[model samples]
Target chain A: MINSISKVINDVGLHARPAAEFVKLASGFQASIKVRNLTSASAWVDAKSIISILMLGVSKDHEVELMADGLDEELAITTLRNLIESNFK
Target chain B: MHYTLVDLLKSEHIMMAVQAADAKAAIELLTAALVESGYAEPEFSVDVWKRELAFPTGLPTQPVAIAIPHADPDHVNNSAVCIGVLATPVEFGQMGTDGSIKLLVNIVFLLAIKEREKQVAMIQQLITLIQSPALLAGLISAKDKNQVLDLIQQTLNEEHK
Candidate 1:
């Protein structure tokens, strides 16, 4: 299954702490999740990797697409989308 | 596998004065340069930037400023290093704490490694280099890539011995 959601980076940027937090959150679910820039047609990267997310150069106003495939795909997508939408607040 | 900093850095890794206005531009330019040097795949740079944004790599120093650009091993297509010297200092999120950093960051060590374990020695060597005030000054003041490479080699060699 495939689901897509877009959100602007609300925080200053995803820097280390936020990145680590995002990874920790993503790692909890067994489903495979990948995030990518909506403007860039690159393969989705492992959502749980801090390094992978940082390389995307996502800044404020940059839109990202999160994709997931697995048994709990819906829950994973919704949760991640909410996380991004709320800017991890 | 054993690799020297010289082996990790290629001709393309050497960029003079990057004309980026902000962090995003800086990251894009640096990543493209790494790809050109064959140090990493084209996609690898973007991966690194994305990861960096998520987890800022700026490490605060006592006498000078430095940042180590590293990303998940899965995003790396090869084992290599890229260096960047910004024309103007940019804000890098503080390492190990919640703060903002705006130092004249003259050095950026972009590491693209295939295996996380293999990076231990290199990381140790880098930590040593950072702790040395004299060496750090020499690195920041080095005029060219040759000088930078030589300094790195000397420092690493000294650490090994």
Candidate 2:
């Protein structure tokens, strides 16, 4: 298992379009991915679920922890961390 | 300026027991209300519809399914939430899917956000409201727009904590 933490810098945070983008990318990986909003102290939720991501209510400057388990966990963590660091660009 | 969910919702924007053929019709029905109320421009409908086609917003919540359709800020004159309670459920492509997953949505929340900063918080408020099956049930069973508005206000009021 691999875990990493990152900050959401986008103005809209992880809702709407950004949530969709995050879930879509997370769904492509075979590893089981989970994310929790550290800033909000939200419970860990499936990274591929849109509703779960939306429920996190992660706003700008909020820190989130992403965890991946199974094969390709490293790649998944790297890709998703890059996506967040790039502000979902 | 920061706006709460109650501040963005109005009785005029709430349509109860609406009947629509499909997702587009449901969106158009709510979009028409927002456009007519001068909260959103005419092009707002087109932009929102296009975005819906690409990234559907239907969420399969318990007790009832709902959809939150929104567009870019460019066509919005004011930030408002237009709601429609469909008398009969309509099929909407599930969000975070490859257009294959579908959900029969009974209610639609058309969010017209003029400010980028408020979008995430506004949606979070809605998400908080919908997570409550009791509130969602009230929204589904409420007979009139006033009742819907009241329920939403009640839910949002609790959001302050």
Candidate 3:
């Protein structure tokens, strides 16, 4: 298991499009991924569920923790962290 | 910020047994109804259909298949929701699927949100009100326009309260 902390930089935070992109990427990996908004009251939610991420209602400049566990934990955490850092580009 | 789902819906905005051929058509039918009923502008339909093509809203809600199609705020005038019940299920791509996957959708929720900030919060609220099987069953079984409104209002109030 591995985890990384990152902040949401996009203007929309994790709203519709970005949230969908993040979930799509996270769903591709075999590792179990969960995300929690550190700056908000949201608990850890399944990163694969777009509904879960959207329901978090995370706004810009919010900090989040991404955790991954299973076969490709290291790769999942690194790649997801990069995705967030790049603002889902 | 303080509006109920019923506030955005009207009988003219509801369609039963809609026979749209595909996802785009489904969105077009609903958005057109909203536009005609003064809830949105004429361009809202085209923009919504385009967005639907790109990011399908077909949610895998149980008991009855549903989708929520929305457009950019620029194309909207007033916030509105148009509901449609399909006679036969239509194929709609699921939201957030990268490669491609279709969900057989029976109900459509076409949204025209004028305020940008309200959209996310509204979707979140809708997620809570919509994920219930009993509420969805009520919506699916509604026989009249009043029944639809009552069921939606009852479920939303029950869920949010």
lDDT of each: 0.66, 0.83, 0.77
Candidate with more favorable, higher lDDT: 2 or 3: 2
Worst 10 residues of 3 chain B by lDDT: B115-124
DockQ of 3: 0.15
Best by DockQ: 2
Clashes found in each candidate (C-alpha, N, C closer than 3 A): 25, 0, 0
TM-score between candidate 2 chain A and the true chain A: 0.98
Clashes of 1: 25
* Isolated chain A TM-score, each model: 0.86, 0.98, 0.95
- What is the per-residue lDDT of model 1 for residues B1-161, given as tens digits with 9 covering 90 to 100? 76555666775776656677766666778778766655666777677677666556666665667677667665566777777766666666544323344444556667777754444445545566776777767766778878877877787778779
> What are the models' TM-scores?
0.60, 0.70, 0.67
Docking class of 1: incorrect
Which stretches of candidate 1 lie above 4 Å from their native place? A1-89, B98-104
lDDT of 3: 0.77
Docking class of 3: incorrect
For model 1 the local lDDT of residue B84 reads 74
lDDT of 1 at B18: 62
| Tens digits of per-residue lDDT for model 2, A1-89 | 99999999998888877887887788789998989999988667678655568877889999999999989999999999998889888
List ranges where model 2 is wrong by over 4 Å.
A1-89, B159-161
- Where model 3 places Cα greater than 4 Å from the true spot, the runs are A1-89, B119-121
